[model samples]
Target: MISYSKIRTIAAEKKLMDIVIEKDYVLDWILWGISENDYLKYNLVFKGGTALHKMYFSDWRFSEDLDFTCIKPINVDKLREALILICKDVNNKSGMKIELKSIEASGDTKEDWSYEIKVEYLGPRQQSGGNLPTIILHITYYEPILYEPVKRTILKSYEDIPGDFFILTYPLEEIFAEKLRTVLYQRCYPKDVYDLWRLTKEVGD
Candidate 1:
């Protein structure tokens, strides 16, 4: 278990409030741990803005959710159960109030089924200074991963979060393509524009 004092120290060093640092730490830990869970093992490829922050780049923007693409079919009910258990384990291990709020599935056809899990972390309310923080994990299946040579990276322990796990990520070019598509098709997010600019500056057009 990570001590509150330790978390506080890290937060202070990063110039981030304790609640922000603590909630992020627990959510990151849970994501890493979920990748290694035994009951629910599959080829879950991480992606989206969080993937950029966690793997593809050095940008420090905070991401409140995890996005993944499953390389194979998944049992939604079983996955939900596993997540509930994982949340309990995270609560016990990290001394954070982690709860599995809900799991929602969507998609038009069998070729693309997406499951989004909403997790709530209730910290010391007084210390947090507001409502609980929520983390979302979105997993989509059957839509094949486009890019080959997926970058293999390791997620190392940070602050109070402990775990070293390998993460499979789409290449920079593919991530760039995804951001472009999002900008065109979906509600424009400022972060996507920012990411595109960064990609242009670093990786070039």
Candidate 2:
């Protein structure tokens, strides 16, 4: 496991909250692991706020949840096994220990299935109730992709784990469209408005 001091130092260098960097590190490896996992590689289409930051805007605010739209129906047992394996792989590669605390599955009567996973990681700030950092994973199977997901390159400045990673995700325009869709659904989400503004600046007009 990487020393908490190293995590703290990188956070200081990046001028991000230590908790943010810590979560980002955990997220980076999880993404990498997802790309490596054969089932998840095809099943999960990266989406939502985290995908926006990692795949599109570098200046976007740090996102706390890893969200994906499942293109194919997957049994919960298989998903649970896949994520457990991914965490083990991430631990080996990044020296960051991530434990899968819980995986819960639910769906509306129409079979719009979804899963929520809670994972805990070692952290210095101890923000979580148990003095550990946690990251939430939300996987929804019903969101139709408005555009064909593309394989995009992902990067992080951390020298510890170097290399370009890739993920299958919605294009910038689709993310913007979805953000706009959400804005209409809710009256007071400032983040969605902020994201729309930034996305407009990136994609133009």
lDDT tens digits, residue span 1-205, model 1: 5677876887788788887766667656676667567655356777777777777553446677888877767788878788888887777766767888888989888787899888887654324556567888888885455686374554443645554555767777777777878799876889889887787776686
Task: Count residue pairs with overlapping backbones in model 1.
Answer: 0
The residue pairs that clash in candidate 2, if any, are none
| Candidate number achieving the greatest lDDT relative to the actual structure | 2
Following a full C-alpha superposition, what root-mean-square deviation does model 1 have from the true structure? 2.9
Candidate 2 has its poorest 10 consecutive residues by lDDT at 122-131
lDDT of 2 by residue, 90-128 (tens): 888876678899998888743587889998886434454
Every model: Cα RMSD to truth: 2.9, 2.3
